[model samples]
Target: MEPGTARIAVDLLGGDDAPAVVVDGALRAVRADPDLHLLLVGPTEVAAAVTDALTPVQRARITVRPVHAAAGPAHHAPRADSTVRAAVAAVRDGTADALVSAGSTGATVSAAALGFGRWDDVRHPALVATLPAVSGPVVLLDVGGSLEPRPATLARHALLGAAYAAVAHAVAAPRVGLLSVGTEAGKGDRPRKAADPLLAAATLPCGARYVGLVEGYDLSIGARADVVVTDGFTGNVLLKAIEGAYAMAGGPPEIGGAPRAAALLGVAGTVVVCHGAAEPADVASGIALAAHLWRRRATDRVRALLAGAPAHSSPSDSIDTEVSP
Candidate 1:
């Protein structure tokens, strides 16, 4: 194996096409990264599918933690011993450096929060997705972590995105923006108007600065900001729309298409949440993302940055939003 080994715990029963897709993805990841090791968390039969495909040398780096329960429908609460939960437990117990799951986002989030513990001063965690922009990568937050967010939550997302951009993507002096109807200061709803000033006044890490409100188009082009903050409902819709548009255009940009996976911030461990309908390539990408973040020590660095920022107070009356899983 190569140096800098990153052991990632993967939930084999997490996605819509469990076991098969997960097995293929895990096999691809192992073959691609010489330093990658996997602790497969699922049924023994499912785990066997992955191990059987690898050569003896490759198979030596694989371990299996057999947990048969899968993350079911979004509405059904996560079982205590679900595969995703077991994956999280593996990370918490130092058995793995990170985790990747193409499961129900809510279940994965809940499992991670319970297992890893949230960072201080962060009530609602953020799921951050990086889009390949024209100028560079744009970090967008709250893609599905918190569907309904208060103005304070949006500001917190700005902090998370800014730090994440710097820590993960190595963006220097990242520019932050709030997604709104227009770039004008007072063009958005109550939450945007409220968040604008809060973000402007807040202290950003890695020399990041708030660049006022930005439009949806800014997310794809990256002409205006390096980090865009919005409630999970809006961000999720926008991400899906962009992905669909890429499909309609024959293919994604040469750099890449919209990511089908995202990193969950606020929790203490390195956790990646892939789309429930993820394909083998998407699951493989998610595994790579988790390993990259773990190697960079991103979760710890981002949390430390937030620790130095001022606490954001949550408001009593917050807007509620919803999306289908």
Candidate 2:
């Protein structure tokens, strides 16, 4: 625990089982971090569930903003009055330093972008997920943020991932890699083939080098790359697959395991999104992650690194991956 007070606005109506898991998770987070203040956004009663469980001192730190509507689904357009949107607004208005949501991925991303403008260099906002691996922590990006990033976007994510590993996770001189069908030079599909050359040439900010191609195995073992870049679809699918394996194997290993929460990068503020079907512990982890990032000033450091990137390169490129609602 960092000593600063991190006011995190939590979406009480977000997630598969809204109000309950969110409430439970909020309570767990409050107990875990003494300096954490929560802006509970949802119905008054739902927010009470969290405050009611806290000690008198802890209860004093929570502020409630009543929002009745929760985002319906990925297909439905997020309403201005939705809890997720309100949480984002709290951050933009200086009421909160960060936000955590277990809502529809589409809704959360849209809300965050609308409230906190994206960085000038980041055309595609990336969702970065960290997995505990044998070697250490492996940073995977574009995990459902942008489904299909163009070759140029992949190249951008590679650099972004490398910076995130260095600044957020403290990986020194992180090794970057492109996720491909195989580790060979020309193994993946059309997009991977195209992105390969671009990533190889792209200059990473944190002394990171492109280590050619890496397979799915490399993500778990972390023997090849510290930061793995791929399309959101592939990264999202791969993250879930690794989590499923962890569940089947009893529990995550001691070194670390799959994280249910992901941090949204490219946005101006700190934001964490949890799995749609997240449990109480999962949502708590999301809140904790948000606090950690805020304390480290990771988002600002990443933006600074992006500004230091080459000015000649056009970071705005098109991608062809299909995004599922």
**How many clashes does each candidate structure show, in the order listed?**
0, 1
lDDT of 2 by residue, 195-282 (tens): 8988887889989999989999989999889999999999999999988888899977788677889999988989999999999999
TM-score (all chains, Cα) for each model: 0.95, 0.94
Segments of candidate 1 deviating more than 4 angstroms = 1-3, 314-325
Which runs in model 2 stand beyond 4 Å of their true positions? Answer: 311-325
Check candidate 2 and list the clashing pairs. Answer: 150-319
- Residue lDDT tens for model 1, 1-325: 2258899999999888887889999999999998899999999998999998999999998999999898767766578889988999999999999999998999998888888998887666899999999999999998998887578788888889999999999999999999999987799998788788888888899999999999999999999999999999999999999999999999999989999999999899999999988999999999999999998999999999988887655441243232334
lDDT of each: 0.90, 0.89
